[model samples]
Target: MPRRIVIVGHGMVGARFVEEVRRHDPAGERASLTVFGAESHPAYNRVLLSTVVAGGLTAASIGLHDPDWATRRRVTLRTGVAVTAIDRPARRVLLADGTSEPYDELVLATGSRAWVPPTDGLLAEDGALADGVATFRDLDDCARILELGRPGGRVAVLGGGLLGLEAARGLVGRGVRVTVLHPHPHLMERQLDPGASGVLAAALGKLGVDVRLNVMAKRWTPELGLECDDGTTLSVDAVVVSAGVRPETDLADDAGIAVDRGILVDDRMGTSDDRVHAIGDCARHPGTVSGLVQPGFEQAEVLAGLLTGADPAARYLGTPLVTRLKARDIDLAAVGDPLVEPGAEWADASVEVLRFEDPFRGRYAKIVLRHDRLVGAIMLGVPDAAASVIQLFDSGAPVPSDRLALLLGRALPGEATSAGGPVGSPALLPSGALICRCNTVSKGALLTAWRAGATDVAALSKVTRAGTGCGSCQSAVSGICDWLAAAEPAELGEGAA
Candidate 1:
């Protein structure tokens, strides 16, 4: 008999694992699988939950279409079933319901939870785990914040990271007075530089968000509001903590899995115990636990190979370059180290520095380059340039003599060398061209599945395993389904949506 697999979490990483496992054994001949999710609702896009409150999507619309995906894959999905403990010695999982399930091979995809700092008086009259003070990490958290929607309401968002800013933006759009407090001076410190962060700070200020920098939240006063270390207090209601995430390795720790910051694993995503594996934000392979979606998907791919009895030799190097998808503005991106070299001297014009700052128009574009290498770039009103920049960085192609021309379609004299491409050809598509990056499914694969009679996005997901991770790619995948249905001359149903 095939080995029984029990996956702990049904979030993005776990969901991708299910997709990969099923895709590897579509005929359900290789393995028996089960997924236990802590959340009652089916998996939705956690990344875009802020967008849901910002009027970008609805509650039902945010959820994944494959509610019975596990069932279809012959993998049992137990939503709201919390796994309290794992008995690795016996290869069994202890559930909160006092039921224990045995597995020959176990995968702990238990994703991370939001790190909530200890605060003062912010909690309800009840205690620390109060109803009022919350963290926006899941759909239920989004719902709670949405429930607190009142015009001109004072709301405080702690952390000032991407999630915090997104949450503040959503709250502000809803007429809530939003203030973002961060201990650090810059936002998205990990992804952006000081100069870019300065630009972002100014942009956020224009949005009526009071951006507090270099001031840590000392404590919380239930009545007066947040107490800052700088001896100042902001009178606000409700504090949403977005202060990063710690890996969910408690289960792994209890199960005697080697862990350092996160559950330790190899390139194959296998734990020290060969029969066990881990993925997503939970697993720290080679001193890294990638919290980003791309790395997590890559990890899923690695784990998928291992479970299917493949060579599993494909090593997962860390994601060196990545694109940032801003919610409502310019594409502020970083590929490799964009920081300036110490004591390096050069004329400003010699190195291309395109600066388009129109404060009145709320637009800013500054691209820093040293000898046409595409070192660093920042844009306030240019998202189209983002794709090109990412492509240039990804391919490491030598920049055309006139770098600005590539950005703005202006042909400097003698700078028209190999620009543009075959409009209708597949060569234009990135080898890693994602039909849905959220689920790590490729366009070519999705198209092949579509031609194979997987007509709708929902059916396409059940077949091709797309749009199952983050629902951000759902819009793109849905568009593809529409194209296939229209181009194929088929009578499509509501599933096309």
Candidate 2:
């Protein structure tokens, strides 16, 4: 009697959608779920692949789903089974194994695939990855890089974006000499300004990473290293390509779903057909950007609410993106439009740009405010300021009058200050403040889990799904746990008295 929901592509977003739906329909009174994943392994956090390559995390550590998770929820999860086609007339999906399954509604979370350039020797004649070259995208790529990248070996990473830089840093941690080739002159040009990029480059240089800006890989081979556009060759044992990713939209396109660069969806994550819905990297809604897990997770929550009738009026306006780089020895977080050109529109208008740069110390902080509200910020080498800025941005709180003090990690006028300055504390954060952007977990949710006897970080993670994605919020989650532990004894002492 329950509506059957068939989901394609069991990546992070898809797995999350399953969890959301099950949470709403715990008794299976509304919907029965079936998920088809093309990958052989269970869903894992793609953002933590760099940490796995760096030997900090194992393949199993970053997994999102537990054993028998689907079984306990009465969901059918089929891994290693690709959905070949969608038969709209019959409302059934064809599988690679020549089987078919009928559905009342369908969801696509195929996510995206790494896009490697057409450089010579990067791909074989059959379109497979050639020897000594890999794209840093998924768990398989991490395994390949780990096997190829030996200590004291040489590695060439093509691309200077976030993933590329992370890959380069991870290889460096493995004692491999790394050279990053980027077409853009600055690192993370999309998220960082040129000034911040320079500071980051200096930090990377100190960490023993060779950064080659404004360069492109013209060709590559196993015998010879990457050949640059400028007629230069560098010898390397392995080549890791972090060029970028393209959404996997072939299934949606072939099935008559509206497709642009990604599958187009509405506010409720519904596709052209009423019976079909899409979310995650494959879903392109207004104001939604790909490659960030937060938007996809938000879309999943919205769609689940709509599907389960838990909140029929629920709508996804869009996610406020917070970008964090998880590379070792580097701390950087960028939110909104931090990169604004001088003399450009909004430069002299309501926008106020405050910047502090210490190039020698490899530190930079930039905050963009509009009408005295935090809109965008870039913080590097300033963890305390980064936390406060992120809180202000997430909460849409008013900026204090002492803007410079906030940028310099000093306490505001009414705030309590420590000897080292006022570091943002979990206790100080608003309950609604986001603790996990990827999963949209809030501080209140974490506290609720803590009150339910999930005292440690690991237990809290399982209960509230905090500190799971990208693992950037682990420090924040730990801070909350520490605060709770310290507060519990005080409450117990007061009760005894």
| Most TM-score-accurate candidate | 2
Go through the candidates in order and give the C-alpha RMSD of each one to the true structure. 5.9, 3.0
Q: What's the C-alpha lDDT at position 416 in model 1?
A: 10
**All candidates: TM-score:** 0.82, 0.95
| Number of the top-ranking candidate, with lDDT as the measure | 2
Q: For model 1, how big is the CA root-mean-square deviation?
A: 5.9
Q: Per-residue CA lDDT of candidate 1, range 1-497, in tens?
A: 77688888888778777777777888667778888998998777676787886777787886664566666778778899999888877889999999999998888888888887766655565555454466878898888788765568888888888788888888888888988888887887876666667777787788878899988888876677788889988888777888888889999888787888888887778887887788888988763436667678778777777777653576676654454543554345454545444444643554655555555554545555666766665544444454355445545666677666656523222211110111122223443454454445765676678768887877898786575554434555675566556553332222221
Q: Pull out the clashing pairs in model 2.
A: none
Candidate 2: clashing residue pairs, number: 0
The ten-residue window of minimal lDDT in model 1 covers 414-423
In candidate 1, the residue pairs with backbone N, CA or C atoms under 3 Å apart (3 or more residues apart, or in different chains) clash, namely none
Model 2 agreement with the true structure over 19-42: per-residue lDDT tens digits: 899999998889999999999999
